[model samples]
Target: MANTTSAKKATRKIARKTAINKARRTRVRGCLRKVEEAIAAADQAAASEALRIAQSELMRAVSKGVFHKNTASRKVSRLSKRIKALSA
Candidate 1:
């Protein structure tokens, strides 16, 4: 349905970006889930480590434009707070 060559190229670029963004989102969710699981299990060390990983993933996603920087920061802050509370 793309009527122009440029439109076809744009479609291709969008598809590739979509796939990449999806992968980044999936990875961030997994990392967040791992941190949540560790917190639920009351493993402070594991939770801390997982949070660290999740925070890094979030930051990376933000830098890559998959997520807003403030959004990532808020997520990291909330997760870290929960993790800290679990340790206390």
Candidate 2:
């Protein structure tokens, strides 16, 4: 229900941005899941590697505004802590 031409254009732009953001969110979640799976399996090496990749992807998502900076940091921190605990 975009009445004006500009409104229609804005809607289109929003749709494109929504798609991109959704993809980024999915990617970040996938990365986090990989880390969690590794942790659950108690594989220290795999968990460590997955955490590294997840941290990178999470930070990237933060940069893209898919997640807040502190949110990403907290997730990374908690996951790293879990990974450390795996070694103990």
Candidate 3:
């Protein structure tokens, strides 16, 4: 659907970026799932570690423009609260 030369090149770049962004999102989701599972299993230590990892991944997503900064912050806040509640 791209007609101009630069448009065609931009389209290609967009496709590549889409793959990278998708992978980043998948990894973030996996990290979050790990945290959730650890919390569900009542493993406080593991849940804390997993939360750290998931938070890092979410921040990375924000830096890469895959997520908004506020969105990542909100998720991190909620996840941290859940992890804290597991201990309390």
**Evaluated with TM-score, which candidate comes out highest?**
2
Off by over 4 Å in 1: none
lDDT of 1 by residue, 1-83 (tens): 79899999999999999999999999999999999899889998999999999999999999999999999999999988987
lDDT of 3 by residue, 1-88 (tens): 9999999999999999999999999999999999989989989999999998999999999999999999999988998888889877
Q: Would you give me the overall lDDT of model 1?
A: 0.93
| Model 2 TM | 0.97
Winner on TM-score (1 vs 3): 1
Superposition-based RMSD of candidate 2 using all C-alpha atoms, in angstroms: 0.6
Query: For candidate 3, what is the lDDT?
Result: 0.94
Per-model lDDT: 0.93, 0.93, 0.94
Which lDDT tens digits does candidate 2 get at residues 1-88?
9999999999999999999999999998999999999999999999999889999998888888999999999999999999999888
Clashing pairs in 2: none
Model 1 quality (TM-score)? 0.96
